[model samples]
Target: MSSFNRFRAAGPSSLMASAHPGGDSPALRAVRTLRDAASQPRMMIAQPFGPQGERPESDPARAFGANKPHPTAGWIPPTALAALINGLRRWIRLRALKIIDEIAERRMIDRTRTLDSSRHVSDHLLEQLPVPVWVEDESGRLVHHNRAFRALFRREAEALIGRSVAELLPETSDSIPVETRLDTGERRLDVIIGRCRLTLPASSPDFRSIAPVGGRIGTITDITERKEIERRLRELATTDDLTGALSRRAFFAAVEQEAERSSRYGSKMSLMMIDLDHFKQVNDRFGHAAGDRALKLAAQAMVEGLRDIDALGRMGGEEFAVLLPQTSLSGAIEVAERLRKSVAAIAIPVDPHPMTVQLTVSIGVAERLDDESDFDRVLSRADAALYRAKDEGRDRVVFDQPRHRDIFPA
Candidate 1:
């Protein structure tokens, strides 16, 4: 009988474990199985036969399997079949382990590449920003700053790196969108600072539901020029260019506001209408240039005589107006008299010669009534008083007197 047949008759234990003196460990069993399978005869086949000598119509040896060409067809040995099945099982297990390892390695490589790409993009974006930008870590230390940031501080990026934001900009706040002033030598910079917290993407496996890892990112902008322009615009809108007093429109607006306040609180307020006496005669004799000088001089004197709470404005040509808050009719008359004296004291020099000219003012005073809220009503009464002042004399103050209404027509 062949060795294959003899081994099969003895059973599976004889092929796997019985060959080793010490019981078969898994590794030893695997080795012995492979070794035994290798030692089997190369030529072997399986064939079916009937009990009585008879030829089957189908070929009996066709189904038999072997690793090599057989000299004669025969039944396949059971031990050979067992060894082939065991070898196939081992090959499948090894292939599965190799595939799992490959997948794990590929995932690690992809993660690394993604991280590198993200870091490169972040650095490039920060570098290209025009405004000063910086990032701080959780400990409030500046971890990164852009080129603009370095330029703003007038220092090298290397020197500023790893420094705390508090050390560099003492007034910078962690809260967003604040305006601050920085005095750098002779220049004053108006800086606006905005802040935001940095966070990792939600797709990252390391993402946490709590606060982000990095502290905050900040941006700064200089607005000094913008602020200066705004100031100049306000001045132009509120003041007259020729005399530097409130413009006619601005003065009327102030009168309306003061009238509303007086009516609301039952407080006393007064208005004065002033006219430069013989202003037209001065312009005709000395020319318009001299008239302009006289007007400016008159405005200056009036400004100097008035209190801080009083507002003065050029109404038109030679007419001017003053608003006095918390003042009575008598008090308005006193201020008007002082202003008239101040204007009379000014002696303006005519151009192209040593000749000088003097000017005087006529002022009319009227107090706002608690029942009358309209500025025009108070202004009309003051205008009537001014006509009276001019009729009586050129340089004097006149107060509006109360008039009684006639119940029946004369």
Candidate 2:
């Protein structure tokens, strides 16, 4: 038999028969290879990887396209069928992937809608709450906030969303924030937002671990009124209501502080004790109201006559003391003399039409001695000197002469 005819007889099935008329050529060899691959398994739409992560020259089906059918003889190549099957498989695979993606996308959209609905409900509840409430994402960006929160800033929610805490509170402080409202003047509320760690359970409840979910969620408290009340209460405690001077407790505290400063720094400081002369006679002759008026006038006179560094305090009824920081005994004596003159100048008008009374104060001054670490010694000496002044006759300033005196102690 001729080689060509025998080759044709031994060639692959009709679909894969080579078109080339050449007997046992490269085309025939290619056809043999394709026929072998086709005989093994059907082609599927997949990209298979090799050991080296490379694709081979042909997918099993690609072999069919290379051996097209003989045009004149009207016989199709196995490659043509293989190419058609490959195209069909690819289209079907693409369609399946597209369908899966669409399903996943729909589910995600539904989940997002549900989350948005729940957030809307939570937001409404927060809005109705009396205090301000806010929520931030994991990155500290403002995500959700209530109507009250927006109202605090007087801003729309759209303006605030996606903004960070630093951007919201321009002061950049975690302390009581004096935040500003949009388009409005300053509204000073001590906005106290206590931060707490936000967390999420990343594990099951059986072996739970807390993981940080995000930024912060907290309610704001306005403590402006409470702070103001506290301030007023402190003032009432430390201040004498009738005389507008430091109360006995507050005055003694001031004296002690001044004494400590004087002792530590080796600086001179002085104390004075003053008594309104014939105060009891005036009160008995007129009335307690007249006496109260006289006391108020005397305190006002002392406050006006003294320096800012000086503290005048009403010790008891009709008796007062002055604390002179960074001053010597002579300076205190000068201050006491002025206070006595001022008191002599004061004339108190009682409730009645024809009753106006005059007064005088006997003043005694003492310096903080070198050895004196305690302010009590200075106060006692001043008190003793005050009595000495009263015995010598009222309305005079007497300086306590210490035996061993060092005005500035080292």
Candidate 3:
């Protein structure tokens, strides 16, 4: 029989099956792989890999194509070769695209997870902050608050979030938005009696320079105790520690201001200079402790007898001054007489002495003239009147004018 007829009778599959009957054999598997890789379904053909344009001596294709009249055993018809080449190109293109897509998908997933992890860590840090911290959106709605903020305002996350930032903060926080617009980047420290609210400028991103920041982070510092200390310090500077009255410097400053007002507006204002009668004797006989008690008693009495608009200040030892706003000369004399009687009525008991010590005050009264804006002049006039009262007698009220003594029987 002719070679072509013989090869046709023994098909390629039968030849492969007869040589390697076992389906799982390595050679059978290699042959199957080559066949599947070289062609699409319904067009599959077995083709052996070999040298360029030539079949290797041991190539399986030799037996199949050997009978062909073509001189080269590796030769394939143009149509079948084109089908095989096109199939390989299509498979490579589709597989490469699929691999590229898988790589891109994995990268995107990793990026998303990384961002989520970073967000969680940052949120935990904000939650653990010591100072009251808050986050708000551009609409001024509260987004998040730290534990400190919740404790200070006594609100839960559910209650605060999505609400207006204005509602979460005190009315004093209004300045924050206004000042934020100024964008000077200065701290705004608003202190109330029990609560001091501090908003840090740099940390908070409220609207743009022209807008309130919708998602802004800010801190609120509690300075209530600090504010209270400052207020006490201010009081210590301007007030007398011993007598609870205005100190000499503070009293003069106040009088100077009032004197200017009196001169400009032609308002009535008066002053009094008082010297405790026989104060030296009391200090000598009862000791300084007893003298302090006497002084405290006298101050308490004067404070109780004076009007709210009046001010009392200790000039020095055994001497005191009074500022009476909106008072005339006659009015000043009446107040001085009343104070004298009140001081005279104070009876301090000394333990060792076992006796009630009686004291009196000599007062000098002066009225601020319409044209005189200098309070030092008014103070000098009151001092001179005080000397006259001391010269004439110990326990009487005298004025800067002549024959202005008034006495009451006790």
Candidate 4:
């Protein structure tokens, strides 16, 4: 029998009707099934025929007719139909494999292009950065650094790469908030270093490795100008411009602090109030320039006699105050005596040749008492003693005695 007649005998009645060209046929149904399978690429390829070869299967190819035995008398063997179906399955599998390979290749190409673009962007950004930036590997080896970093270090990228952080920054610690000075070429830079953890995408080639790898990113900021500004500001706030002694405000602040400490800890603290004897007379006789010279000379002499912990400041025109921490009344008196002698010895050279003027200071010493909580109270007593010193004689030191209060009405 011919192949068509043999298929008609073995196939179900519904399948035979579908095989015809005019009506809905098995060939068209197979084409529709293939289209659906292509839409769901992940789904397994399904068989078009049933076990008995009675009709096309309903699933996967559900558009085809249901199983119903052929009405003809002579039955064609199913082996022939099985052979045809097997051949069709092989074709479908080969086609599916080809499509899968093409998709995989396309994805790989796109991923490579994306990685290259990202690398280009990163390089551009690093180059454009104004501040020095560097990257180190897990072993603290320098892997990459920007142009600013190279300029600061005065080294080429090739020389810097693979070098350890210790080699680059010998004096700097690896700890956070690292501060170090870099003396490169003729420039001196005060650098502040900060770092952060580095993370990469899971798709990165380094994601699967024998040893874990990560980067340490750091930024270096130059603070040399800032440090200089701070130093100048501190000098202006804390010291007198003319005599190089503590400023009036700074001296009072120091005395207030010392007074609090003495009261809190029951520690000894002494204050001395000093005035240049006949200072106005010198200004009147030798002019204000000589008066300024005399004042400068007197301050220098007093400073030479004082200990390092002693603080001296110009209170006003000719008045000055000293704060002596951890000193008893006797020690303060001793210091005052030495300062008095030192002041008396100072000779101001008025005219470049031979003419000189001698100066002396009257000092009053007051020790912080247990009852005195305020610095002003100590200062008031010291002022009274100073007046007494001036009254008795200039160039002498006077120790203040506590006043006795009368219990009964006078």
Top-TM-score structure, candidate number: 3
Measured by C-alpha RMSD in angstroms, how accurate is candidate 3?
10.7
Task: List model 2 lDDT by residue over 310-331, tens digit each.
Answer: 9999899989999999998888
Cα lDDT, all candidates: 0.73, 0.72, 0.74, 0.72
The root-mean-square deviation over C-alpha atoms between each candidate and the true structure, in angstroms, is 9.4, 16.5, 10.7, 13.3
- Segments of candidate 3 deviating more than 4 angstroms: 1-115, 168-213, 402-410
- Candidate number with greatest lDDT: 3
Candidate 3 clashes between residue pairs 3 or more apart in a chain or in different chains: 137-214, 137-215, 138-214, 138-215, 206-213, 207-211, 207-212, 207-213
lDDT of 3 by residue, 239-342 (tens): 88777778899999889988888888888999999999898888888889889898889988999989997899988887899999989999999999999999
Candidate 1 vs candidate 2, lDDT winner: 1
Per-residue lDDT over 1-410 for candidate 1, one digit per residue giving the tens place of the 0 to 100 score: 76655654554455444333355434345544544654554555334356653335464443433333654324445665565576546656766888899999999999999989998997898898888877666676777788887887677978887786557653652333422334422222233333322111111222122223746666665655665677789879988878888999999999999899999999999999999999998899899999999999899999998889889998999999999998998888888989988999998899668889899888888888766888887888888778889999779998786561122111
- Show where candidate 1 strays beyond 4 Å: 1-35, 42-214, 282-288, 404-410
Ranking by lDDT: 3, 1, 2, 4
* lDDT of the structure predicted as candidate 3: 0.74
The residue pairs found clashing in candidate 4 are: 18-25
Clashes of each: 0, 2, 8, 1
Q: Which window of 10 residues has the lowest lDDT sum in candidate 2? A: 199-208
